[model samples]
Target: MGTTQLESVPEPKYWHLKTVLTEALDSEFSVGEILPNERDLAARFGVARATLRQALEQLELEGRLQRRRGVGTTVAPPRMGVSVGTEQHVWPGGPGDAWQSVDCTEAAPPAAVADILETGRDEPVHTVRRTRMSHGQPVAAELLYVPASSVPDLSAIDAPAGAAHARALLRELHRLELEGQDSAVELGSARADDAKELDRLPGAPVLVVTTRYVAGARTAALSVATYRADTCRLTFGDSGGVEIHHPHRHAS
Candidate 1:
């Protein structure tokens, strides 16, 4: 794409520049290649530095580019296709699950989670942390909350704390018949904890997928998952179903 002065286009100059830069990225740049400096890019595109910066920011939000600390901006890889359909009724730590259990602890849940669990606001629950990976890269993080009532059979002898306790809690949860799962997807900024887990900056855009697992006429478990917005493509299933699919699954 040749650099053409954008003085008369009906659309905003920066929007037009974003289009041109996108074309150039597809045709001229490879994945992980660092882009030219802002000054050079502005000169090459015949746009003001501010306009070029706007275009670059937009591309980054759209998953076309990445700005890394000390690494500069680079071409981004293909967005991973993630399915958020709710058609199946299953436990969290079932066989073939993509998310790996990280740690488990007993702590008081947030008020909102407590409300969902129908427990006292200050009541402590079993909180399990998990993470998902693709191509050896962190793609999502999750916090699974299981109330004591949900995993009554979990014992210290059967499983200790940390990841072992997490697996045990999941196993105990499976004893109850899974009535249904409800999930909601929304765009949110990454909190400090989520950012560290996903290797992103605080306040970076993220896709929050909240799920409630129902059993025995109550919400037995709650899952709040944060997926990297820049790398995940969420597709809702028909009839308001929710499932998480990783298109780039590796063979075991």
Candidate 2:
């Protein structure tokens, strides 16, 4: 037989690497699986270390990979979907509610929060902190601020102070007939406290959802919720329509 050799295929330098890595994550890797170190992976792929790192970084931003300081990169799980809307609703606190009241405080609302409440910067407000757990995993931290003016008769409420007080304040708020609500979403990094609450390292990417509740021509309350970008998808409106996936790509 005559000796014959087939031509070698050139390895793609960029997008193709991403595709290959994504497919590997889906087919072969489980969530939280630590990937092979960059140098080893590069050698195995016959690509430069820089090229491999670039692909990894892209995956990290898209929430498919999580990189730790001492720990290496690992496969990330899919984000959970939480609804954000203006519709009058109550926390179900039932099987699928996924929210738990952690702690509460009475303090002056921050300048930004006060501005949203249409109150003075140093005005006293009830601050309620809640942690939202999806599938038994912490996914978000919420700071709810209710101005005193919104709940003038809180003294008669029987619940303990702080979170209980905040919950009472919410009940009073519901009495006014929620006229409407406005919400804004922006990209943010988790703060130290919020990061701890969400069980993520500081500076981790988050999606901030700011909401203002209105009742009878007055701004009632302000809620600032920080959701882990790697593990949550904030859904608004009815979810019956076409599925709009996350902005980033994920392994199928």
Candidate 3:
């Protein structure tokens, strides 16, 4: 597309520029490709630097672009499809699971978790920390909480703290038959610790997935997973894949 001056229109100039830029991105840019500098883009679009910046910011928010720490703004790939439905119901560390164990500790879970697990508010549980990676980048962090009642046979001598302990806890958990699991997803902000692990600035948007595992008619364990909102698109059912088309872009 040539440098066509956008005529007066009802929509804001930045919004129109965003549309034009979207077309350019689709036609000319490749994934992970750095975009032209702001000054050059403004001149080419016949819009002010302020308008160009506003459009760029909106695109970033929409997951069309990413501003890396040392790299300039780059075109982002289609959002990764994350299966979060009952069809994939299994233990957190079960075979084929993508999350890697990071650490394990014994501590009282949050009040909400305690309530769901039917444990005393002051009761300490085995909390396992894990991270999920996609395309060589961290996409999600999870904390799995298991009460003593769930894994009563686990001996203290075999399991201690840290990553090894986390594996032991997961092994003990696998011994029980999982009756079922239910999940809920919500928008959330990254806490400081999660942000550091995720390589995102504090308060960045995230998708929080809370799941409760049922075994023997009781809640056996609870998991809270936080995924990068910009990089993930949640999928349900047993389809194994999803393709969603938008007029501006196609999301997978």
Candidate 4:
């Protein structure tokens, strides 16, 4: 008989380590429980430190692990169930909204925002920036574009362009009857500024959520929110759940 040879397809060592650690997490680890230091874990796994870290990073992206700058890595609880949609459309700052406005400025929006707002690219808007915190950790950063015409009563006289000004813009928006709102979500990389707010390195994976608010058939406002892809689960309906199978996927 002719000799038969089979090619070996070895999975990457890091992938094996990630799978083992994941099983350990399910069977042995508890949420918020700290894992052993990296050096020890690497030695125990018979892998290099860098290989071990690669596994940990993927685990963190799955929301199965949490690592802080100074604190060691620990098991992360389930990602927060951030309600992005419901049977009834709700405006930002509506009841139970998690966003906490930080500041506002009247400025021209970027090209993307201007396009959706159907306004002149150079036209000014109330750029309200807000942050979303979950379980005491910042999980998302949002930039809301409110056209000046949408809030005619909002004047330069309305509190200086700071936290109060931001709040006022949202308050004015709520007064108008919101006819409808639409949204889309996609994978993206965090910009440098957004990365800072989300406590991640630049180019970190993020879930970009774009929304448009309509009033009386005109687009009144737009929102571009970036959620930490590793730690946030945006729930629009039955689609809410931790991303398990593709946990290793990252933004290009």
Best candidate (score: lDDT): 3
Tens digit per residue, CA lDDT, model 3, 6-106 = 88769998999999988888877778889889999999989999999999999987878888888899887778777877465698888888889999888
lDDT of 2 by residue, 10-117 (tens): 866866798888877877777777899888899877889889988888888777887765877877767677677736444322234556676668889889888878
lDDT of each: 0.85, 0.75, 0.87, 0.85
Residue 126's C-alpha lDDT in candidate 1? 91
Model 4: per-residue Cα lDDT over 72-105, one tens digit each? 8988776876666655688888897879999998
Separately for all candidates shown, the number of backbone clashes (residues 3 or more apart, or on different chains) is: 7, 0, 0, 0
> What's the TM for model 4?
0.86
The residue pairs found clashing in candidate 2 are none
Model 1 global lDDT (CA atoms, 0 to 1): 0.85
- TM per candidate: 0.82, 0.74, 0.87, 0.86
1-252: candidate 1 lDDT, tens digit per residue: 789786874888999999998878877777778998999999998889999999999999888888878999988777766657647777899886899998999999999999999999889999999999865568899999999998877754467778888887888888899999988899999999999998899999999999999998899999999999998887666444344432322223
Worst 10 residues of 3 by lDDT: 243-252
